[model samples]
Target: MTRRRPRPYDRELQNLRLHVGHERQGPVPVGWYFARFSRHLRRGEVVPVTYMAQEYALFRTRGGQLGMIDSQCCHMGADLGRCGRVSEERLVCGFHAWEFDRDGTCRKIPGAGRIPSRAAQRSVPVTELGGIIWFWHGSPAPEPLDELDFAEDRRRHLYLAGEVLVCHADLLPIGEHVTDASHWAYTHSPGRPMTSVQLRDEGRRFSFLIQPADADDTRIYHFRPYTLISMASPTTAVAVPQPGPRPDGKPPRMAFVAAVSPVRPGVTLATWSLVVRKFGPDWLLWPANRLWAAFLWRLVRRNHHADFDILRWMRPVAKDLWSVADGPTVRAYRRFYRRNLPPAMEEGAEERVSGMS
Candidate 1:
């Protein structure tokens, strides 16, 4: 039998490069918006959803319906969030008493001789799923929501979640922070010696393998309905596999899952979760777990602060202006960006022209 020659790693790297640049101005991929938690807008609350900094009124009906409409009253542009009221499942603009239904149709215009047919036509696309409100701004045509798949054994874990609005910074920078492993060495040192330096460095070499949830063959289990396992990277060849079923017989529901969405161009809503097994269903366990999670949350918060400082400085420049560090995962990420971002943006032509002129 003849043995085939092993494929070269450099060849794989070349194929994976995604040339991202800032010149081709269009909306970022819509995958960036789905499944993001909007905490300010409580259940059955109406709030404004802004894209690229422009506002659109978003609301959920008492019957568990979702809706989005122009933030201004069609008659006299009044800020809806400040002066709007939900009456009988319709959003009434306070300035001129214009009423819009769940579909964004102008249901009533008080004292108008006759409501124009066009008044009832305009509506923005919206979707509600798994405790999230999603507004589709790209096109009128609807697209299927991304589905999440979990392995059978992993499905038994319960999940817990929380959302916070950072005072500064956008979603992209924060999402990128998750892939940054070097920060853990210094910022997350916490006076403890690095026990997993090699693993950390190795993990950083992996790039995001985006696929439909149905296509992903990863395990996802959660401690609660809200907590979900998103994806997991395969173990490295050199690493020893930890024992399963845990010493306690109850394994965590989800090892890790993060769903980060860009609520608007400048603002981001990140929904993250941790899965744990039901520890006897005792009410006491809830508080105990929360306190422990809070400690972990603080560590994460400090690391985010460090990353925010770095990314905030780099945001003004095109991503192409940056260089990938010498690591397998970092190189893979650079390649992915190079291939996905438009050629013009990847070349930084926009920045170059702006500087020259």
Candidate 2:
């Protein structure tokens, strides 16, 4: 009899890779939820929201109230997105006829008449603040939204807030854009041209400072550690202006501050609040400003697309594999992540790739 050839290990190796990665990389701790958009959700409109860095189902009622619930129905685990609705204050499951209230209470069970006292009632805790909605995924204790210090005059600035197209990238890479100054010169060049780029000799050092907002003003805040600090207004002048012919010679207008919060491991809620100074009769520059805003949006959108591709294809690299960009903000974000995020023991002690370790 002919000897049988040995089976190739490719498929088995792939499965092993996936399992090890998951065991090493546990779920990100539940953080803040994007509650503002939840408030804006319309009836029949189901949006994916994140808590504990995992996705959840977010829905609104015809009466303009919001509810966050498990994405799946309790019975048979049907996707609530497929068939779910608000009946009174409860969410009715399309399959198995189970009903869950806003608080995740089992109010009614079909064929059973009423829900039993022993049945488990699990619902996400939700809160509303500053026109945003928030939910807790960890301990039952409620975290205060007021803890994030919004600028005093944060509301005064002209603001445009919305989300970007969903991508498979992790939230950290996308959020890091805030501190990535180098991209402005290249990725954003198509829309907003950059005259020069600069980085510290050794590398960027992260420094965080809080600037108070004027009363009724809308200011952007960076959340690091346990505090929220105001982001500085964009400067109007460039160190070295573009080499080409000057168009009015004025510095490129600062569009607004864009912030990304991880709703889940791979999904992020990006909020861009456009801030513009109001000029009395100097409205002639408004058109230019608007054009610049559109350009900046395009630039950022392209950058995100690029990152999406990278994230989808590249395997995870250990922290030592890459060096932080030479910038203050970038340095600060790395420090923040190191300090706040759980340690490898909590995350599962998996050895990183040689260079990255």
Candidate 3:
């Protein structure tokens, strides 16, 4: 008897199944994610980072280069983040003075002249942008961070909000919040109907515009996959509010980029980074820009409070319900998730992705 070949797995079908709120299970998608604020890690400093259920020793060497390696020292399983020191361009283990290069190779071992063949520690790819330190949670030779359209803007000016808040939430829901038009009225602005929503789908990304009934400002949202961004999980979202003209007759331009990273299964840390166009000289515009960005951060913080209250305890549940009021942008976002999913992850495993355990 001849056996028939099995059909290929359908990502679109899987996307639709999960879109309607079907319980999702599998390995989390691989991508860049915010690990810590760049300022917090000064030169020659080592910090501990726990994300995606793995611990890392994120360090800035004396030479001003960044590296992330397994937090544990192989000598005796000592926590590297707690006992390691950055020496010039390498991490020196305090336990036995075992030195490791950025590539996870053990170069020196104190007292003993010979190093073990398996004394090397695992290292993760890391980059710095927009005042955030990010690490890749997938395969080696990660994509370049400069590929992001806003890369220059983030690097040139201050982009981070002063405070980063941690919440018990899912990555997808938090990233898709900007595209969720229906909930704005009830969740963010009461009595202001967010009924006038328009969308422009660009396959990999989709932009939407919204004008609330009680507000004069027009809000625009850009949602896309976070494959190369400095701060995003599987998806990245940006929201811009176009308010009326200022006293100078020129409308102020600013955007809030939502950056979220999954710390574990259901817990995520989210923050808003402000991006503004420079108006005047650097000496004057720099301070003004920071103040303006800080003001906007407060607004974002207030708005997200409502979201945190609801998302903190919510689980990924599928409802056999559909409504046009949810808008096309939401549907497009669901499709985006379906197409961008990674292979099923191992269940209850220490090493969920490559370079992480």
Best by lDDT: 3
lDDT score of model 2?
0.42
lDDT of 1: 0.43
Model 1 error, position 297 (Å) = 4.9
TM-score of candidate 3 on Cα atoms, chains taken together: 0.73
- For model 3, how does the per-residue alpha-carbon lDDT over 59-167 read when each residue is reduced to its tens digit? 8888778999998888898878777888889998878889999877899987787888999999998887756777887653576553244545543455654445555
lDDT of 1 by residue, 271-316 (tens): 4443344444446576766566566555445544554445434343
Candidate 3 residue runs with Cα over 4 Å from true position: 1-26, 145-148, 151-156, 195-233, 241-253, 284-287, 318-320, 344-357
Name the runs in model 2 displaced over 4 angstroms.
Answer: 1-30, 35-40, 44-55, 110-113, 118-121, 128-133, 146-159, 189-325, 328-331, 342-357
Residue 305: error of model 2 in Å?
7.2
* Better structure of 1 and 2 per lDDT: 1
Estimate the TM-score of every prediction.
0.56, 0.55, 0.73
The window of 10 residues in a row where model 1 has the poorest summed lDDT is: 232-241
